[model samples]
Target chain A: MTRWGMVIDVGRCIGCQACTVACKVENLSPVDAWYAPVVEYEVGEYPDARMSYLPTLCNHCTDAPCVTACPSGALRRRDDGIVLADEDRCIGSRACMAACPYGALHLFEEASGEVLGDGSRGRPSLLEPYTAAGRIPGTVSKCTYCAHRIDFGTANGLMPGVDPLATPVCVVTCPAECRIFGDLDDPDSRVSRYTAERGPREVLRPDAQTGATTAYVGLS
Target chain B: MSAPVTAAPLPQNVFMDRWVLGPKTQRVWGLNHAIWFTLMGIGGGVFLVGRAFDVTTELGRVLGLPLVDVVSFVLIAIGGVVLIADLGRPLQAWRAFRNVKASWISWGAWADLVFLTFGGLLMLPDLEIGDSTPFSGLGWESEADGAGSVMLVLASIAAVVVMLYAGAVLARPRSIPYWHSVAVPFQFLASSLAMATATVLVLVVLDGDDVTSGQAVTLAVLSAALAVSMLLHLTTDKEAPGKKESIDRLVRGSSRTTFLFVSLLAGTALPALLALVAAAAGGARNALVVVALPLLVVGGFLLRLDTLKAGIYPPVTMPSVPARRTRG
Candidate 1:
């Protein structure tokens, strides 16, 4: 019922990868994997040219194609409408990866020299210790809206505490506060109010009918 | 030079004799190519089994037996073994799971594994149980009652994935136009089915068993439908650059014409006609069905081999154009 989503005000984005870095630190994601990527595109030519930066992550669509494409049921949507991955159930099929339109999912692989207690090395680990343990080899991963933290906060009837290490490093590190994440169901939430005041455009991939929940605002 | 006439300097053509084909061409035809061919062949075998099952289910009474499953399972097993053995690091194949984001080849391997496992379960009942006469009404103790049904469903799903994987792998961004279309997957699926039916027909004949006239006719009809669909898909659209080129290559026979025409048409069509004639004679036409089987098998293999070799690289222009222009 909580419908987790993000509102990226592209007008405010400066193309600096603060959100990207924050995401890496908060998620404890691999050095190469960026849970939130800010893609820069230049239009026109020379002096008259203009540039725009679009930050993209899991769209968490109402009809997520990745969900249907998964053969092992590893990818699922929670009761609160947050799409998440259950690493243990993943068989490493990658069907969901192929199905993703936004290229949001990052297939996590183990870093070199990082060995598990079971003697397995080079397996994927989320940078944050709390989420790292759930990473598995041959499996796909994507944004979870910090569901673990969100659940904890909900239980205590308080604002979700950012893991001193994980509180969505991207949201905290944003120099321009371009990326905003919150419960879309909460009328007073920043993301909800922003969407109501200035509607944002959702990124749509050709041939994919999934209606993405993540929206970008002020991109003409 | 003529005036000097010093043995005419022993013709420079001698240098031509030392020239050998380039390694790139050889590599294209080497082990990796063989693996591709072998995969297609195995796919053909699976197609045959599916066809045989369809035929037997429709005409078992006429044939006085349902032997299609028996023959199909054998061909499928043989093909599966060939594919698995062809893997470069067959032992360490489990490592394919390292990157799910970038690889469907790995997923294909897993699908094949599931297919083989479930296929074996389905075969046990046919091989060990031997007809319903002995194990009749065993009250849930029967093989058919337990793992057999479950395995059948699993194998069916895996088979669908197996059919689709070839197209999905080739449909990556910027690949040749021929392999880019959504229709490509369906095309592969159809062709594989046609090829598989043909393979089963051949094996059935080799087993010294005759297919019923009705069953043969049905299979022939399906084969014809598959052939027609293959042609239509190859010719209809010219939008996707990769797909158009692939279709052109298939039609012109530059690389795979011989395989496509001779093997697919000659092998499939000849037997299919025989089957049609046999069907017209009611259930008495066993001879024609026998003759059509081997042709179908060979034709199916040819179809698979051609499709696999008609490989296309991704569009490198946008990504690598600057380097090429500089070199030029």
Candidate 2:
């Protein structure tokens, strides 16, 4: 009954992409496929102008449209509320990509992780190992909230979000301490407490009505 | 102060079209989808009309197939091939049939399969090709009428599913501003009917046959409904995120010429008007049918293309502010 969720305090996010880079390194995601991206933005007129960051990733919705749209039964929601895609079953229809509202999913092509001779996104990539693993060409890939680490940690008798070993790399790597991940089902959990304090916890594209698990704190 | 305001809208994504605050058109689906959808619509539409009229005019002894059967089978076959080709993984397309309970594409795969299999069976009596024909002896002219009748019904049912799938798949994406409407399915359904009628009329004429006044009138009506559906889809909640921008893409953006001139004015409206006049004026009906049917069919193609082009994703950020500004 642990409904895993994440709370992002955008008020504290300083546009630093440390979490983005950390997630890339940990997930071994294609270099262009951002599991979590800190979108740098400028707002207001010159007098009130300011630079801000809107860090975005898969919301892992309870009623995920991508899961419903996936023709091959590739995408599924775990009992813990984590949405995942079984790359093997995926037909590469891109229906999940077309259906995702938060722009969290990406289609994997072998060339996406290509290394150039100029040593830019080249040889030293963590991708070489991942490509040999679950990275199936022509299938879809997305954030799992570090499900591997979660399962690994929990199996080893550790708590996620509380223990560094179990937490999503992006949440743990955020220098601004803007991200908190924990079970929303438990009122005592850090993620639940943060929401109670924040009160009117909001999700991006609320009109989508996908029951988004990732809650945000700032923007205006 | 009242409601949260986003940073002034970001300009369109120019650097390889990454991200933008403005509506971003989905480029993943384009010409392939347009052709595939057009063929699906025509196949379904034409099959419906052919079955309704029972036009059994034989083409040749090669397949011994009639005009309508050949048209529907060829188009649907080509569409299925195109759909498979369009996939990021073409060989694994069989997995598309597994999730029909949830996915439209799954339903489409099943529908397309049922349509082809049963429809192929329905068209079976046509094979006077050689001794290789298993259904060679069976014919509507013979006592196997009941069995043939069952195949006809199944094929017709599958045809309807194929037509509906075309729109339903596109409409499933709620994030898309233009394609999310209920009107899309109607537009596709109506367009399919109109295209089918036009195709039938053209084929009937080319074969030197005359359609009754009633069939001509139906064509007029179906084309008019197509026009209305197109208009309804075009006019939606313009205030919603990416909604107005989607409209701009049609009215003033790069798709302007195709939207206004090709689809709306000539392809849709003009065809409807021509069909009406042709139906009303009696003798000149053939000439007008010749002019209008092709236009209606072409317009149907553009409708699929333009609507596909019109889909725009709203910016994901909600622009919520903390109770007090912290950083700035």
Candidate 3:
């Protein structure tokens, strides 16, 4: 009964992108891939208009369309609610990309552009040495929710939402303390507590019926 | 270490359409999809029509292969090649067969293979080329007759799947409101049949054969159906956020080609009207039927092209920011 989830206080987010940078450093994501990107938009008109920063990442929905649309069996959702794509099994059909509602998926399209050149650093983009499924060109990728960290930390007797090592870097790195992560199944967990006390159950696009683990607060 | 990523701010002006987090047009499938869908539909359509009309056996070949069967097979083969080439990893394209139970594209892949294999074997012993004269086939013709019936049945099933599969693929992404309709698959099937029927009509005309009273009526009905399907597809999803924008995109935006050609002239009206006239004219070889046949096919292609262009990504709802943040 350990369903991993994250909640964001939209009002507190300062759009500093520290978490965005941390994700890149931690995950070694492919070039042009924003596993966690804060999308900035100007909402409302004139006097009522305000700049809004919506931090977007993979929702890791319980009923994920990408997992279903994957013809090559590349995308899979774990029992803990973490969804990740198998780089080796992917056929680069782009079906998962079209299927994803959050646009979480990214394809490392070309080896020449994504790889580090000059032969000194013989690498095809950055590698996630933690997971057996390494990065490759023409395969899709997305936020792993730092599953490697959560796995290591929990196996060694650490709570994910409470432990810096176990929590997602986006939550750990946010300067404004905008994000919270915990086991949603545990009613006493921070994510659960926050939702019960203050957080709105409405995730983005509640219409999609994605059963998205990520929820938000401070919306009209 | 990965490169330090730059922040991408949404263009303020472009948001004029919806103002908040706006709909993004899906950029994944484009001209390649259009080509694949159109050709595949036409191919499948031709196979269905040719079989339904029982032209496979009546039309003869020196090598014992009917032209209709061979043409349909080649068209689908070309479509399959184009689709595979468009994939990011064409080298591992064979891996598409891994998930036939879930993915429509996988269904298409398997369907294409079966259609080609069974359809290839099913291509008939037909008449001499350029004339109605039935040619006696080579020695094994008598032995091939029984198995050909079973092959025909299998290929027909595969052909129907091929015609419907791409639309099913588009419809699976529920976030894309424009494509998330039963109407899309319906429209795809309709236009596919129309295109296939039009192709058959064109072939019949070119072969100096009289336009059959049955075929002319079928063309009129299918042509009208294509138009009606387009209208239903555009009208029914009026309430969805992306759908209005999709309509605009089709009518005036990048997909105007579809509105002007497919919806208005080629695919629908001209063909429908002319087919009716030709049918009324007692299947006469007329200039209008000749002109409308190609246009009918073009409209079908345009529908596929424009529908892809018009696919608007569902706009994400902005969390209601407090009043203090609204100042421009």
Candidate 4:
């Protein structure tokens, strides 16, 4: 009954991009591949100009368009509400990419090193363990909410969101402490408590009716 | 004096600059899909029109071969190859047939296979292989009767479905508003029909026949309908935020030139006008048919390309800020 969700506090966010770097390093994401990126924009004129940053990732909607759009059924939602793409099942149709309103999904066109240097160099050594499925080419990938870490943490009797090792890298590494991740279904969980305490936090594109699990707090 | 009556602080704009979560999705489909859909249109169009016109019975033959059968067979075959080529795993395309309920793509794969199978069967009599078709020993010529007509009809049905599949695939994506309309399927269907009709007109004209007035009328009506449908599809009320943005991109943004000029004007308008001319003249001017045919084909292509180019992923907007902040 664990419906994993995110509560991003935009007010606390400094747009440092440390979380973006952490996500890339943790996931061994390809160069220029941003699994979690801080979107910054300037508001108002010079005297009153205020810089705002909104870090974005997969919302992992309850009713996911990517799941329906994927012809191969490669993108599947787990019981805990985490959506994962099976690289083996993927046919590189990019249908899921088209269906994703958030643009979280990305298809790898070439290897990470090949783009920056000679094609002779292979994947980064850090990616060796994760590259078993060869997701670096012709396969669509996105943030999985650090499912591997979550699974490991759960197996070791650790609570995600309560433990540093169990939570997503972006959540743990946010120097501004802007991210809150926990089970939304659990009333006692941090995310649920935050939702109850905070008045009327909103999910992105609520009009989409995707029933997105991720919510934002103090977006101002 | 209450701290000298200082002015109230500026309340922060929570939803500043319409910031939303996630970046815009890049267009997944490219030249491969464009080529595949264009080929499918031509193949499907030819087969459907040939069935309607009874090209097998009438129009006799060019060099002792039924032109419709040969042309449709070749086009369908090439289209099928192109479709398979676009697949990430060509050998595993059979997996698509196992899941008919998945998407238009699955159904489209099945439609192509069935259409090709039945179409090949229907073309058996006119194949002219003469004891070299591997199955010539089975006396395949005798099978070209009631069963042949049934297979042809089935093939035609599958072909029609194939023609609509491209638009159906595009329209299914909830993110792209421009393609999300009831008009998309019909517009694609009409374009395919127009292209096929024009192809037929070209053949009729080249064959020295002024007896293609019926086809010219069909072409004229279909092209005009296509033009109207394209206009309506682009201008219709888009309730979805994503769709509204997509329509804006098409009508007034970067895609405006291609959408207004190539797709609508040269592609749909001129072809419709030319078809009308052919119909009015009782299909006399083969030159008019010749020019109009390519225009319809090119116009239909430009329409598809423009649609793909203009497709905009939904914009990220500011997630609503809480009415009140929590201490946690």
Candidate 5:
């Protein structure tokens, strides 16, 4: 069983938002909802100041608080150790979203109506296509590791044509190639070896016992 | 030109006793609370009936009582009314469906309506028709009867949802941390149950019962447990900045002492002790249960009210800090 994880080398990242755009397109995320976001932070002052860009997505922790907090059993871990949401069972309670310390999950809202240039009401239509049965409005949506593409890729014994494993889209679309993704269970995997060779810092929320899978290397 | 100097006004701190809420929103929340209380009361009553009917072997006919069905109907009705009342425009509540993709409140409302209609339909056959009479020939039938077995199951499910919905409403990310815990639903359910038990004890006492030993003891134990849980939540967990400060103030101030001593000890503990003594003597436990019941109920109400008020703070998200080189 492959335990998927990612290694983000912040030292090499340029802060370009190509990954964010790619992720939005690949995941079909709604406007204002980014599965992968590049957070920029400024350091020092004046001429000597520097900026750091950290691309954040779901950590997919071993002890995911979201999974435990979901009362309806809508959020679950897949066989390959990926946290997935069963949209059909989701009641849109947003409890899982609250439990996530990393603010990864986004409660999606379908487009209700279009607004004219003068702010007048326009026609309303269903925005996103249903991916599962019994999926209703007002439910939480989040990064699914591009599970659909992953499944398709695994079945075809090839890399996903449409960015399967969604492997953190921001990482894949990075012009600097600072992001690496692979099975953490495999010692020789690119991500595993990279982290093993260069110590990486895992983001830890205070008092939260979640063991985050995503690691950041060469970050102060 | 000579600059004119302005005198600085002295700052007067205003103490807030009551917070004014929008009329419609306040009405919605008020109705929501009332409906939930009523449903919980009916559910508790049904459970009591089940205990009475089932535990007593001699009451064979009552064993098959429609207590559950009646409670289910009542719950559905209460839930329905709450959903309707929660809407901005009661008449145009159906517009809620327009944002089904993004609004949990709207979805939950629809679910409540569906469940209520379904549960009510299942309970129709067992509804009891009670004769109502006025001065002369005026009469009416009360549709409170239902098969206890079927109604119990439905009511139990609905009750769980009700509790979940209460918690879920406040469980948004980057929102109030006090309401963001996974234990919120459980806390709500436990408090609601405690309230129901207290209410029933009150009714029992008003009906001339002079003893309430068992009920009093239960209330005391539950109140203590709730207090402990609340304390743990406030102390151990990492809370939002505003919430933490407010809770700290509440606990350190006179509010804590008043709530613990007057509400918990005097209201709950004393009555529980009295009830225990009465029960031991095999005397009028009914009287004790009655006295303690009101106290317990009041204490529980205060507990919830204080917690809610104390935790009223806007949520804040800290700006991300840049990773920097530290002095080695």
Candidate 6:
């Protein structure tokens, strides 16, 4: 009954985009598609003006609108509360893209990987491990929270979010240590403790009533 | 002491179209979707009216097919094709058939398929195939009238569902301010009925069938409803954050030409006026039906296009507005 959740401490974020790069490289995501984008903006009037970064990603809602809207049942919620799209079953209707309030989901138009000059596809050795599981064109895709690494680590008797090898690339690579990912149901987990301390964290468009699991600290 | 307060500079990203949703962006369903909606709307509307009046007058057969059957079949068939073409993975389109719980598109796909297959079957009796053909006994005029009637009923129900389903799909995207209106679906229904009436008029003329007074009245009522729905859509209080901006875009911004001149003046008012005149002038003004019908139909399409193009996404970052009481 473990429910995976993300807690982003906006106060500690420096808008460095290291997590964005790490996520891109780890996922072999399209160059334009950033699974974790640090949105930098100025807030308040001139006298109180300050630059701030609010990083955003998939919320992985317990009541995901995308799952409900998906006609093919391609998008589904895992027992562990991770929302995923089954590529084989996807019809690419883009309904999930429309239903998502966070703008987290994206449609893969064309491959963004390296290609040789003579019309040949270039292979990246880092991405070779995920070749059988990479996204296909004409389908909607989003963050998976590094499910492969988590699964592999769990199989070898390691704890995700606690062990570096099992943690999401974004959380591990964030220089300012703004991101904390762990099971929300575990009272002893860091995320659970953080949630108890910062009881009124922010989730994007709470009015949408999607029951989003991703929460942001220092959002106000 | 409290810190001095001054006007904060507006966030640069607020004006940026990316990150913040606005004009000419955020079309999850685009031209193909609009086309499919239009075709299906017309087809369904035509079938409803055609059955209502029982207008079975046969125009001269082209390849042994009546004009009514040809038009309805083409509209629904092309709509089905366009719907399939809009999908990113057309090969996996069959997956839509696997689930029909909450998805309107899945229900629409099933309805479209049933309408096409059974509707084609219903047409078998009207066709002039030779007696030696194995399917000769299955014609509507033969022993198949009961079955044909049943198919027509089912197809008509399916067709009506298809018409409503198109609007529902567009309306359910809560993030888009322009699309999340009750008026939208009603506008679509009104336009569909008007377009179908206009199309039937054209077909009746082609079939050399005399235009009836009751048909004229029906067209008039539908046109009025269409006009009111358009007004309702434009004037409703859209309290969603960016909805007012979206409405402004349609009424006075980039989409004004089509919304005002085409959809309003040329499309709605002109047709309504002509239909009224024809109703007043009695049988003498049947020629006006020719001109008015095409205008009404084109106007119906323009209304849809305008509505589709006017859909603007609600801005991701909500803007700060100071509260003040003002006497209305």
The prediction achieving the highest lDDT against the true structure is 2
State how far residue B193 of model 6 sits from its true place (Å): 1.6
Better of 1 and 5 by lDDT: 1
lDDT over C-alpha atoms for residue B312 of model 1: 39
Residues B1-328, candidate 2: write the lDDT tens digits.
5998779987655322553334456766788988998899889888888756656453222366677878888899999899899887899999999997799989989988888887787667666656475676665542148877777787788899888887888887787867888888888888888888888888887777776677788888888887787777666687677778888888889889998789888998898888888878888888888898779878889989998888888777534332222210
The 0-to-1 C-alpha lDDT of every candidate, in the order given, reads: 0.55, 0.81, 0.78, 0.74, 0.53, 0.74
The structural similarity of chain B in model 1 to the true chain B, as TM-score, is: 0.64
lDDT of 1 by residue, B228-285 (tens): 6556666676544335555555667475555566655776566667777877875546
Interface DockQ of each model: 0.02, 0.48, 0.42, 0.27, 0.05, 0.29
* Candidate 4 lDDT over residue span B1-328, tens digit each: 5668778998664333224443343567766676677778887888778667755545555433568766766776787787676665566556555436557777887888888888777655554454445544433453246776678678888998889998898887666666666677788888888888888767776666663666777888999999999877766776455566667766777777777887789988888888778777853557777888778877887777777776676556643322322222
- Candidate 4 lDDT over residue span A1-220, tens digit each: 8788889887788988899889988887655468888887666678988778878899898888788777677788999999998767777777788777777787765554344334365645645544554654566788999999889999999999889899999999998888999988788998878767773576665545666777787654
Report residue B190 deviation for candidate 1 (angstroms): 2.3
Per residue, candidate 3 scores C-alpha lDDT tens digits across A171-211 of 99998988889998999999888878774565766666677
**Pairs clashing within candidate 2:** A219-B320, A220-B319, A220-B320, A220-B321
Between candidates 2 and 5, the one scoring higher on DockQ is 2
In model 6, which residue pairs have backbone atoms overlapping below 3 Å? A45-B8, B125-B139, B125-B140
Compare candidates 4 and 5 on lDDT and give the better one.
4
Between candidates 3 and 4, the TM-score winner: 3
Q: Look at candidate 4 and tell me the lDDT of residue A148.
A: 93
lDDT of 6: 0.74
Worst 10 residues of 1 chain B by lDDT: B319-328
lDDT of model 5 at position A175:
86
Clash-forming residue pairs, model 4? A220-B14, B19-B317, B19-B318, B20-B316, B20-B317, B177-B243, B267-B299
Real contacts retained, model 2 = 0.55
lDDT of 5 by residue, A1-220 (tens): 7887777787788877688778777777643357777766665678978766667678787778777665456677876767987655665545566457666776554442234445555554433243233334455667776666667767777543224353455555778987777777887877777777776444434335466676677665
> Which prediction has the highest TM-score against the true structure?
2
